[model samples]
Target: MSLKQQLKDAVAKQKKARDITREDIVKNAAAIQRSRQEQKDLSNRPH
Candidate 1:
């Protein structure tokens, strides 16, 4: 499954037992984007 789908599934699972806000999803998505960008940047740098 795709990462986005996995994220949504995770949030849905948590929602079943607790509260999850849109802000939480936004924050997590932002964090993932930042992390992916950092990995890409590192990969492009000279060894």
Candidate 2:
């Protein structure tokens, strides 16, 4: 294989990894938002 082909393959792999990481971050953020909203709801209620 050529050097250029090797570089292209490496770049593609890096991009795929980055995309997966970004997706995980977005999912985690949404979960955190939901948890905070739930906490707020609980605190507003009287015993």
Candidate 3:
């Protein structure tokens, strides 16, 4: 209702959004690492 409260709510929402983005980035990085490792393993296997 108040201006101060509105600003606080906006800031909180932004922080939550940033946290979710960070989590997504970490998960993506882990997935990429796993895929690279799997590729390396496949390359080393004999045909």
Using Cα atoms with residue i matched to residue i, what is each candidate's TM-score against the true structure?
Answer: 0.56, 0.86, 0.96
lDDT tens per residue, model 1, 11-35: 8899864645677788899999999
Question: In order, what lDDT does every prediction score?
Answer: 0.89, 0.99, 1.00
Q: Each model's RMSD to truth, in Å?
A: 13.4, 0.9, 0.5
Q: What is the Cα-based TM-score of model 2?
A: 0.86
TM-score winner between candidates 1 and 3? 3
The per-residue C-alpha lDDT of model 1 at residue 4 equals: 100
Q: Which ten residues in a row have the lowest lDDT in candidate 3?
A: 1-10
True lDDT of residue 13, candidate 2: 100
Off by over 4 Å in 2: none
Error of 3 at 16 (Å): 0.2
Sort by TM-score, best first: 3, 2, 1
Q: What's each prediction's clash count?
A: 0, 0, 0
Tens digit of lDDT per residue, candidate 2, span 1-47?
99999999999999999999999999999999999999999999998
